[model samples]
Target: MIGIDMKLETLVNNGPAVIFLCRAETGWPVETVTANIVRFGYSPEDFISGGLRYADIIYPADLEIAVSKFSAYVEKDYRGKDPDCKVEYGEYKGEAGGHKRNAKGNLGKGRGGYDSFTQQYRFLNKSGNVLWVEAEIKVLEEEEGKACLFQVTVFDISRWKHTEKTMPSALDTENELKRIINSGHVIVFLWRAEPGWPVDFVSENISELGYTPEDFTSGSIFYTDIIHPDDLDNVRAEVSKNTEGGRDYFSKEYRILAKSGEVRYVDERTLIRRNEKGEITCYQGILLDITQRKKAEVAQRLNASRLEALVKLDQMAGASLKEITDFAREEAVRLTGSKLGYLAFMDAYESTLVMHSWSDSAMEECSIEDKQFIYPVKSMGLWGEAVRQRKPIITNDYPAPNLLKKGYPKNHVHLIRHLNIPVFDGKRIVAVAGVGNKEENYDESDVRQLTLLMQGMWQLIQRKQLEEALRTYSGELSRANEELRSVNMMKTEFVEEMRFPERAEYGEIMDYETLYAIDSQQQKAVNTFIHYSEKLRRLVDSLLYQSLEKAGKIDYSFEGMQLKDVLSDAFLNNVFLIGEKALEVEKEVPASLPEIRGDREKLTALFTALVDHAIKFTPQGGKLALEVKEGADNVHIVIADSGKGISKELIPYLFDRLYQVNDSVTRRYQGLESGLYICKNIVDAHKGEIWFESEEGLGNLMHVKLPK
Candidate 1:
């Protein structure tokens, strides 16, 4: 068997025929061919290397006729009942009234059960010499019966063609004309000019679209039935307008539904067939599938849009969180072909969602009366599934009944489709981004695009947060440095004052009266030193507490404590400062005040800070009042001082870290500006509210409300 195979191979290789295999496409791109093809003045490399196609070497004039005949034969043979059918074409007239010699042979099934046909056509060699060849072509089809490749065996027939010329008979000419009308890649249709465009005939190749020609010819399906509903009206209008304008032909592009329920884009070129009276009797048209081309165009546009969106996002450096989120949501809606979108950030614990932004369209279309910014994850609907699942959730059919759906709020924007993706920072789902109401189903492509875009936005968000935090830290550090310099200056002044006493002691004691006067002056200096030392101690303590609080290292021991006792302790601690300032103090405490849950040390510190602030800011003889009373559910404390009150603009920043109203070097107040800020923090830690009401020069009134 091996020897026989070798001999057969040798015979074929030395034969005067060139065998070629090609893709069943428009140009019939060559894949492989026998070495003998070089005898035609062309190397096998030319076709195999994709430099030239089989159609490129076909004689220009005969190319169209050859393709038509070949297509007709393949189509007919493929639809035949016999699996091993043989086709024999009789004599046919050449193009443009030319005559050609008859070339005939049996076209049988090839090695793989594929059908083959024999035909003769003119070809051009490398030197442009015209040669006649008998080409036997075989059609290779996939398992699903779609033709994909062609095998061709060409025999030199120039000698026979030059010796004989034969004219086809009338029957042969009629049959050949019919075959020409029914061939080629396009699906040809003949329709009577009626309401539904009733089909009179359709080419057999229409089966490639998963439909039979007989289905239309038998009136089982109308051309209108196949056209997509969205595109049908436009197609009809185009055809009508052209016909009314007396145009012989017109072209249109529209979508059609194949038998498998897939949407296909087709380019239709229609000719208005008319009778002798020029009245439109029927329409002849061909539909060429352009689905792949349309898809490519859509993909290109989508990619360009995504790139543009990313560029815009990159340009949003230092933008506010709202601005960034709004832009990202809008772009997500546009890119996904959606009508609405939203972006929400998850809390650190991932227990709640804080809505960052909603697309402009969604905000306008939604009519819900209550728009809550923060939502507990457990309270959300299907949109929150991304957070719960820690992955992307897609609902192409939003209206379909789903167990996860908790329904929308009243008058909310209607959802047709929805896609939600969780943005992750490591293992944590930091945010949930979503878009909805796309015209088409949301696929993985949309998921991928949205996920990537949101990830980029998240990175920018993190960067902005870090920048804000750094700015705050820098401001705090600058204030701290200033406070340190002030303390150092005070220390130098204290040292200079001590030298006066030292020099006084060096002088001799003159008399009893003089000695007593000196002793009195020294005592005064000691009191002044004590006052400054206390002020310095308070400054250091405030700085230390602030540092610990910022580091999250402050520990509190919560316990039940008497509100009156806490206030008393705070007053006794600052009694000296009150006496130094000579401010009149008043206290109004209800004996029936209830006990409150708080940290005793922190509570004492909170009150002391407030009292100290009042004393330092109050003028001599100013009144200081402290009052504690019981409310329905809280203990209300009021600390009012008849000092120069805070200005309206400065009151807003009273609790901000390191903020000082009188930040000038020559200001009368002496101490770190963190007393009020620390007081606010301590109150907050005990689950209480603190605020102030004051006007310039009207004395400030501070209010503290703590739950009892």
Candidate 2:
């Protein structure tokens, strides 16, 4: 406020200096500039219209050197100083010209007023002219504790270049001192180190501390007179010790009593100025009001303490939910400096407030035989207010009639300062936690700590609940897997029993005609038995293959084989079935067809099963055809029959295991329903497709496409 006037527009436009304020970031994007910027042929609109940047006015060749030198000067090591103190980079005298290379081997302009300093830079103004200008830059505003805006003052120094060789006049020194002192964030003062530290010089901005410069400069009021009595002795002792120890500079934080009778925190940084004889003469220093910083520090310490307590509770990983709740309540009571704390969970189903946990330092003082912490939501007092509002409820004066007309119940503990927070699991309020009767009134910081601890405990409980659910699911899955294994074993044993001895019986029947000289009736019965026995054997094979396919244990021994060979073998083997059914067979397999990559046994079995189905379903004298064609990428085979075709609605589920359109007891198919299902599994194993197009009472065409 000292350097920034309410009439800043008028002051900057009329004064010799051109002032600009901009964001403290790369390129120093200009927010506003005085109209006097037009003197350099750049309108204020040029800077404010987002067309030009403050850094653009800096001579391109020297911008990097200027920024690099300022960066080093501003970041000069001040490790022993207070960490919260802002650094002051006053005018530097050392050489500031050198080529500073960036990663791209080019000059780079460093960003922000964090590295801001005063210096002379060459400016490339409009109209093709170069000018010498002195710039004083200071960070004047902050956002969220970060430097955000910079106030830069640029004055034409071309005229001063001629008289620069001469020493400055007293008036020049005084004016320069005034300008620098008023522009800074700190209030500058020079105090003699004798007789209560009489002030020799005080800047006009001393009014910021509710004191006038005249009052100090007149020597009627000593600097120590404004010091808070509690901090006066310690401050005097620290200064005396530093002076005797020959330490030229020292910083200390203390309190001051303002004229309005308010206490303000301040950080004082002093430089011990000495005479030629090496004897201390006076102290020159700056005083910065740091009340907000001190408050922040205290809050930060409280947060750290709260976080430590929460982390300790979290580390109790195996602790029961009740134990965690108890600990959280106790911690809340301790952290908020409350005499008692309690957590009440909202039992939604019962419409009741259930006291899950509580901690009281004065439990023995209660007169009631048993504590009554649970009540219906409608019957609760102040604790229910948090639930009703779905937010926190806080008050230092607790017994106000408007707030609690019912007051405390019989034998309830005395309540004064109180804070209650609604605990949330997602958007719903799950619980209400409250602390009561702290010696000091509860602040927002206390409320925040209590809320954090409660939320953390609830999260731990939720996580444990999820873990329990996961464990239960895992157990159920293990049982289901065991049951599946038992069923698979039963299927395997059943197929084994059905497969053996039947093959031997069929082999014995193959020689029935040679062994027994029998009549036509006996021979026909023997052949019929052989045909039905063979159908039964194919059914058993289908069941075994279906079970294996479902269990993911079906095996395929694959090789590159000729489809023609597989088809020819299948036809020769199943031609007897056609003869038995009195059906005509027409086979058109290409002689030079592209070989399909598949399991030879499975392919042979697949074609044989299709022909067998045709033999069973077709009436006597019905015709069956097997045709194979070669395509560019795959081999297509069609098995057609002039038999009673399948229903259109049943085609979709034709390959489903054990599925049949006619599932009644009177259904007439001889074998089990897994034949087409097994064929589909075999083709799928070979990465092929099997499907059919059919119409009821019309012929059916089954198509198989296998990759070549």
Candidate 3:
């Protein structure tokens, strides 16, 4: 509805681009106009194809707000509600024009990108480069064909992007890294896996590992070579995944051997890596000495095996539900350095107690509804309040201030006690333990000591959480893996479905494209399976390495990720190629994708495959868009192109890993067909997915999903 070609002409050199706009909901004409903008070369194809659809461009997080805001306004019809309810959003740049040039009008990248189109928005045009934008939106109405029509105008603010054109001075970033390591007794070294992660750096403190930096950096210092042979595989896997995905916000913890040949515990803190082409590399993690912390944990653990002060403590283990209560009743007199104690098991709703363990030596247990022992929040008693707050509480004074309704049994007053700690299983507070009644009732020191014991008590909790996370991620990964496997198995089945030679009546085998699809499907499926399997392996390894790292057992390199290099090559190769379109390449192409600890070769192959397609489908003057966005653990590269859209019948085939679009050269334009196939493989290898949305005549949007 609003003219944009002139504005796109003025914004090319400011920086990479991101487009935004509000469009009329009128019908096919709007769609046609959008397609024309893309075809005529005003915006990148991917930009137009993906976001132009109604409400599709909204980020996952923004959708609800965008929807709610719009719905509320439409209901009011701008009469009774907030006018500020105007949709505020950025626009996807218009397609570049057929014969466009740089701001200088030099024979350069396609027509330029867009300029500001509204107070809150502008259109993003990358020419032929990658750019991204984040914005809000509003709606407008106007006359169309003698009737009122609704439209949305998008705003693009891509020029503000902080593009990383160069790496930070290595000395500075590295020195800060060294300062952190030297201040602690932690040993650090990079780990490199042949046919796997390769470590290229280590701290001088590695000498504590019985090896100097030189020895560590050399073949003689190979981490895998020194890793406790039993943990080598796990460590390798975890580190690989971490390195591949951006590890900034993630934590890694594990154990390793010191140069003195002694087993040492460690903790590692992560620092982020920033790279050119805007990929957030894996964390440049540094190790800290956690040996003392480890020893303390060990000592605490050993104490659990036997408690000397309480004669019957050893018998507490494996006690039946009834026996457990019986033990608590009998042993409560001495177990907590107190003459009296009690334990209460709360019901599932935490609304009431189902069971109680009280001191036999004590005169009596409080009633369930008594203000002293129940209605956790309503009771001011130390025990009830602690359970309510879900934290430990301490009181050294008998009937302290608000304790127990300010009343106490004449004899019970002697049991000036303290402490109520919630025993949690997952998020639920299943039980509460109260320690009390002694000649020398609990005080600050006792409270402190007991809280330390909570750690061991919570070990089971950590184990449960770990088990759950593993189960969830594993199940999701398994399901996805199974689906891919099914596709592969189906490929074998496809051959059987074929009417071979004279055996069938489909006569001459339907079409070459059909047969080609069958053949390509096999390769695509198999390759895709292998690719994703490799990624799964990497993710598992990365997680492990992170575990080992956070545990202070390893210091792995963060630079081998090579995301920039891979994405760049892939974006240019065929994924974004316009073939012989003589389509001008605009937008800035940073030297490459940022390098990190991922499988470089694999990522590179992925980009190559996608770029090949971008080029193939795009006609002369058609635009292809590749946008790269980074996070703490992964890099997201989106490759969008303007070309004959994918038909409804082709989506399944598209993901059919090895299958290309060209089943028959005469019938399909997807050339070197394996571009999508290869892209899928590469993405899967990197623990990512490949997906797109398109229609006949409309352009296509191909998303290359990869972990950082």
Candidate 4:
């Protein structure tokens, strides 16, 4: 019996399966495994010593599924048995003890049982390599009626799985190839190397070109019949050159005529099939429809050409109307594949046409003794029909009888085909442009090109005309302005001279006061006269200063001066007004004020004007304040007044020349509206900034900052 057991162990070890016996436990801990486990890069001792369990070798992705199936089998088959019963293996039963199962549940078939089950899953070897395996598990029971062990046999099936994936059936391969071919735009062809390249076989997708494969295969049509006549010679030459050069393949692009009479572009790739004798036998090739791609290319080229022409017209900025029309007419001729062209401008009433320009070709070919430049629209020929009909007119057959045709001059150039379009400015037709003698025929494309070019030309002409008129008007305006300035200068000089006479009268009054003692009424009248004369003199002086400044004739004497000293001079100049107003004035000036580079007289005048303005606006007993501050780069002065402040809406225009808050004749103000304007000019001349802040019914604050 010992010798028989040794032989059985040897037989099992030499087989292709690995056997495992594990205690029925949570982790299914291995108690024994066949020595053949070494085939999976593992030693039997590794499992028997409890270092690795049978569940541990199962791939992580398949472990959950394998354990679930094992539990389900036990629950369904051994449900009524004792929980601690040891179910031991009895005999090798062929698939009757349990159902066959796999990790994917693809093999869940066979009769139900309580002792054994079979499954297939993936296992991880020692080196982490995945192995496809088939496992058969049996429940073993002990003599004490308890399930105590699990007997598992594993067989490697990795080679068989690999074969099933890499090799597919012939029918599947053929069907897949056919599906790809039918789903795309390529048409396959096989042709005999004979005259006209007779078609031997063609793909069913030839229907895309409005033809069937049977048409060519049945010899009812040859491949060469579908190629465009204009492109066939070139295609043949290319193929012949490649074949003579011993080339195996070649590609060519040409136009083909579809059965629906539409021209379609195709790109062909052909392979030459030859016999051992170096003679051509057949040709295998593919044809791809490229009609949309070809049309896009043509449209792109046309757009580029149109843009270039428009740019050229735009660059002729100062050209005359005739030069622009002549160049544009020639471009129309070139763009539309015509031999001669002409442009004519219409009058405002649309009653007459004035011929403006003709292409160089037209001018060179015509030998008419009298070429009319202007013609009445009431008695014109075919070209005038575009203007009369208010639309384009195309005559592809020029000699055909038509009611619009009129007799031409004896020596005029002959015409074959003609296209005419009206150029519209808004809803009115401004011009009519015509092109004639195209080689093929005039169509809508020619009409489009001619219309766009003429429209661009007319715009340039109008722009040049407008520019010329502007130049002439500008010259007249400049002359008028100079004359006005001369008259203004004379008036300013006359006002300046009046100041002398006014001073003489004031002196006369003063002399009489010292010489004689007058009555009280007389004294009062004399005082009133003196006051009115003084105000008149000041008004004259302000007018004179403003005129000189505007004419750019005022000279400034810039020198170093103390800001405080300038302020003191301004206060003294306005002492009388401040006294009359009874205004309380507060001044804050730094003891060590920095000197500033400025015009002293102008700066003093600037401050005097501001002080006088504040006095006029303030009530009889209002308050005024002046503060000077020293800054890092400038000296800032603030002059504030508690007066009836300026309205918010009127503040923006306060400093404008000749602008006043109260300008009506009945208003109380008694001076020209030039005080603040003059003050701003004076400050700006000294490189200083002046701005004001005020709110209605509140007070006003004026800030001045000068560079130190």
**What is the number of backbone collisions in each predicted candidate, taken in the order shown?**
0, 0, 105, 12
lDDT of each: 0.76, 0.72, 0.49, 0.75
Report model 1's TM-score to 2 decimal places: 0.45
Candidate achieving higher TM-score, 2 or 3: 2
What tens digits encode model 3's per-residue C-alpha lDDT throughout 512-583?
Answer: 686677667656555555544544443344345436545977422224555665555655554222444666
Q: Give the Å error, residue 287, model 4.
A: 5.1
Between candidates 1 and 3, name the one with more favorable lDDT: 1
In terms of TM-score, which candidate is strongest?
A: 1
Ranking of all predicted structures according to TM-score, beginning with the best and ending with the worst: 1, 4, 2, 3
The ten-residue window of minimal lDDT in model 4 covers 663-672
> What lDDT tens digits, residue by residue, belong to model 4 across residues 319-415?
7666687889988998887999988877655668888777889889999878898888989988889989999999988888889878789878889
TM-score of every model versus the real structure: 0.45, 0.33, 0.27, 0.37
Question: Which is better, 1 or 3, measured by TM-score?
Answer: 1
Worst 10 residues of 1 by lDDT: 96-105
Better of 3 and 4 by lDDT: 4
